[model samples]
Target: MTLSVKAVAARLEIGRIDWSAYRAPASGGPGLRDLFLGLLDANDESEAVGCSLEYRLEVQSMVYEVALPAVGVILAAYAEDLPLWVEMEFLNVLHNIITGEPHRSELELGNFDLVDRCIERARDGIWVMYSRLSKWNSDFLLDVLEVVDSDRERFAVFKAGFYPE
Candidate 1:
């Protein structure tokens, strides 16, 4: 479902809710999902950052903390580092394609492949992390607790998932 930024803002105001309240059991489930998807899509399009108010409400309800580091890592892993690495690899590929010379170091080729794999995995990891974050939508305090408790686990999962496959 395509959600306009204005539509999201309207929903937020209509509910008389803070982003944290979207996690309340009283909140309807579909509403939360739609908001999450909308926010994700916006982020994907570079139209917005992290989560929208609607998304924040859903996440806050779920007891998750929407923090910078977590968001930064995901953005960097996919939008920045992956693309940079891909560009570098593309240059190498172009050189090879033009020169008709085999790359001397298998390590270089392997590294390029590894970086490509890392980008794919990082994309997947971000999706999983977002899914987990979206699961709750009522108890802001609880979500914060859960995020804190799972901090290391979440970071480790991201690292392992994003590492070259």
Candidate 2:
């Protein structure tokens, strides 16, 4: 489905969360946009300093602490009118998060749906982030463990052929 505010609202179950409270002030605060940018721009935490944020692990602290909660806002922001470069960045980041590791376990139901859409787009030759993602050969196990996350994840992972049913 096309990414838009309305679509984001419905798909993400948006408006139930106070997104503003997590906005990164000039001083920096918990925000998914910033985290997504950091992942897209820099190589890692050490290099991301100053460019986007001061990297640190805040388990309970508010530096995004985690990205799952902010996926809605992140997607909504993407649907908004962003510059071309910014839009591409968001797409790339979303693709990476859905397809790559994000230091987390299984994806939420909503995010999992997004993954389904993305994979479909790629396989259909509309877009690509390793269409052979399901192909069992290169780093397949790690990909399954890192991206699959849980029993609920089996649907997508199974379709991807990460494992036999």
Candidate 3:
């Protein structure tokens, strides 16, 4: 499944949507570096400095919490193939949370090199963080994991000469 808002809504069985809340706010808070560092910091207590947000991305409920490293991992892992708009939307949410500002720039979603580098840098952290994700995020991650498994299966079949090109 694609990571569109509509797809997420359908998966969540949401009936209607209000799009305004997902719009990016004006940029004013911290920069991306601080935002990412905050995510990676394990000592940050949610009860003290938590920014909990509830968003309906096209109708699906996304209760996002700042300081959840898994959220960053999931976004980075799925960053490569998503549509540009979807990638922007994800970044907008993160920016909103971090800097209290909406994202005004677009990132090249196809550039997996940065993502790969980050993954290599945070391999163990990502692994530990994945288990700490909330159920909603974990479910979404499972869906993507299924897609990866399906792709692996298809590739294996092709290698076994099941289909001729």
Candidate 4:
């Protein structure tokens, strides 16, 4: 089920929410966190702001504070048709959080399903080429995650149950 950016914003109650309360220690004025929230296209659903490789340095420097609401936005966007970039940076952090990465004990992730959806998106040709799956050949980011296979046939066997017909 695909959703619009406005729909996601409303579901998260971003309009009425105060971001300052959720600010992380590394978040400076209008940090990547705010950028992540601000990029939500409440008026346009066809597209929204694109995160870049530059976001990797900023997001990683911020200690993946983007994991909470920012990652939340990333997850919500996954169910949408809108294209996104550099999402691997955030997804990488989420994977670390799930794997109990040090200095990430405070993170509480409840949606392991998105990880599955990421793989599904790759399988379905419904995701941007710059997202996580692309890095399998380019940067090998998936090596850090449980899924390290770049070959589709092999991955199909390795992660058989993830894609349900």
Model number with the top TM-score: 4
Segments in model 1 whose C-alpha atoms lie over 4 Å from true places: 1-28, 43-165
Stretches of model 2 off by over 4 angstroms after superposition = 1-65, 102-165
Ranking by TM-score: 4, 2, 3, 1
Residue 94, candidate 1: alpha-carbon lDDT? 20
Which portions of model 3 miss their true places by more than 4 Å?
1-30, 47-138, 147-165
Model 3 is weakest, by summed lDDT over 10 consecutive residues, at 56-65
Go through the candidates in order and give each one's C-alpha lDDT: 0.31, 0.38, 0.31, 0.39
Indicate the worst ten consecutive residues by lDDT in candidate 2.
56-65
* Cα shift from native, residue 112, model 1 (Å): 50
Q: What's every prediction's RMSD, in angstroms?
A: 20.3, 11.1, 16.1, 9.2
Give the local distance difference test score of model 3: 0.31
Comparing 1 with 3 on TM-score, the higher-scoring candidate is 3
Per-candidate TM vs. native? Answer: 0.20, 0.31, 0.26, 0.39
Writing each residue's lDDT as its tens digit, candidate 1 over 127-146 gives 43333332232132123223
Please give, for residues 1-165, the per-residue lDDT of candidate 4 as tens digits.
454535374345434435565434453323544455444442343344453223331234333332344434454544444333334444554444333321242234433343343343333322322243542333333332234234566545433433336
lDDT of 2 at 150: 42
The number of clashing residue pairs in each candidate reads 12, 0, 1, 0
Q: Model 2 TM-score?
A: 0.31
Instruction: Report lDDT (Cα) of residue 164, candidate 2.
Output: 53
